[model samples]
Target: MPLLESLVKRRKNREPLSYITGKAEFFKRQFSVDERVLIPRPESEQLVAQTINYVRKLGIEHPRIADIGTGSGAIAISIALEMPSAEVFATDISSEALKVAQMNAHKLGAEVEFTQGNLMGTLQGKFDLIVSNPPYIQSQVIKSLEPEVLREPRIALDGGPNGTEVISPLLEEIRKKLKPSYSAAYVEIDPPIADIALKTAQAKFSYAEVSILTDLAGLIRCISIENN
Candidate 1:
């Protein structure tokens, strides 16, 4: 089959458009993506934007930043490129996804330290900022999703029961990684259970403030946690 024909066939067979094109964009920058990682979505841009703004407001020169579950290196790489002074790290549970993320960091010429481990497992020491866009879809909802979305890796979508399986645990792990004060985490959350995720984060960081942020659609899109 001709190359374009093969590409069209793949899309017709329900391959994600990003996988077919071998690219996805976040924060106005393009990235290479495949079955190993989740496609970067526009709504996630809100997380990135808010993080950058918070970092600037904090005015902490050379802030240490980490991107949890940084599939495709979208969030980490973008922030590294945007904040030349900040040290950046990215982690993923899938080695394959890390390979793609590393490749993207090189292609984009962004300096991001990469680690392979589940959630906060590979991380040590404190970071001034941490951000993530983890799996948030309930198992049952995932089963009923469109074939196009289903084409993505299940690990990147399955949030287990109540859609808080990953997010809830991650909040506790995140609190431990933070720098205690003036540290914050920006998390991209699915709207369906944003409240649940925020509550969990707050519970984990009782001294911290967890706020829900909305995207242009006025739907819950992110949870910002700042430890005052």
Candidate 2:
């Protein structure tokens, strides 16, 4: 009852529920969370699950994977936990977020190599799967977001005027670095922007197919791009 009361109070005051509870569940596991990192959303779990399924379908064992803009290491760590043979690299631009992610990874006994960098800039080599839940909310829209979302780091939420600042750059970089060796890529985005994302992916890669996956709310919450 005391916990519930605290959560209610926090929510009423615009605090993120995860911040009040200090934990969030993703991929059937609880992860530590705070204002320092964006709370892991259920939609992201779908992205992880889809990515895992796609990789397994390709019969690729011990694949190398990279999770760009890894906030709490949810995406990367979840993959590592499911596919022990996968070499997972989790990168973020904020050191504070990385610290939280590192601690979460350690606490969960997930072997994820965490790094601090803007998107895939510091990453090297090719990956069988590259995934990201980058900031997709436009700057102006962020101000109008629910109080809970406003509590997260602005760097992790604001995606410039069009909500594609980080995403555009990340996609461009991925296109440049992606090789025939890599099999698939997955990304999470706002449902309203799914068309723009699909168009961008199509324009960037020839053998890419963008499939929108709906969340429990029936919104197009995740975009999976399979590249040849």
Candidate 3:
């Protein structure tokens, strides 16, 4: 009751619900969360699940994968836990966020290589699969977002004027990092930006096909691009 009451107070004060609860669910697993990181969203789990399925379809053993902007390591750790043979690289811009990701990885007993860098700056070698739920919210909309999201790291939410700020650079980096014969790349984005995201992906990867995936709420919340 005490904890519940405290959480209620914090919610009343506009603290993110995930921060008050100290945990968020993703891919059927709960992970520790706080103001330092973005709360794991359900839509992201779809990306992870789809990516895992894609990996399995490729019939590739011990596939290498990268999860960029891995806030709580939910995407990377979830994939690692499900696919034991996968080598997962989780990267984040903030050292503080990486700490939370490390803790989650430890709790889940998932072996993930954590790196500190913006996007793929510190990454080397190509990955069989690359996935991200990068910051896609436009800067102007950040201030107007629900209180629950306001507490998250701004860097993890602000996607610049058109919400494709980080995405533009990320797509370019992905083009360079992923091998010519990769399986798929999954990205989560606001439903409204789905078309633009797909266009961006298609511009870079000729074989890319973007599909709009709906969340539990029936909202198109994820964009899966398969590069054959």
> Using Cα atoms with residue i matched to residue i, what is each candidate's TM-score against the true structure?
0.96, 0.92, 0.93
Better of 1 and 3 by lDDT: 1
Error of 1 at 120 (Å): 1.2
lDDT of model 3 at residue 2? Answer: 93
lDDT ranking from best to worst? 1, 3, 2
Candidate 2: segments with Cα more than 4 A from true spot:
1-11
Q: Rate the local accuracy (lDDT) of all candidates.
A: 0.89, 0.84, 0.86
User: Which tens-of-lDDT digit does each residue in 1-228 have in candidate 3?
Assistant: 998888788879988777877899998899999888999877678878887788878788989899999999999999999999999999999999999999999998999999999999999998888999999998888898886677778899999988888888898898888877756777778866778887888888876666777878888776666767
lDDT for model 3: 0.86
Question: Model 1: per-residue lDDT, tens digit, 160-223?
Answer: 9899888888888887899999989998878889778877887787898889988888898888
Rank by TM-score, highest first.
Answer: 1, 3, 2
lDDT of 2 by residue, 175-225 (tens): 766556447788888766778887787777767766777878788886677
Clashing pairs in 2: none
| True-structure lDDT of candidate 1 | 0.89
- Number of the top candidate by TM-score? 1
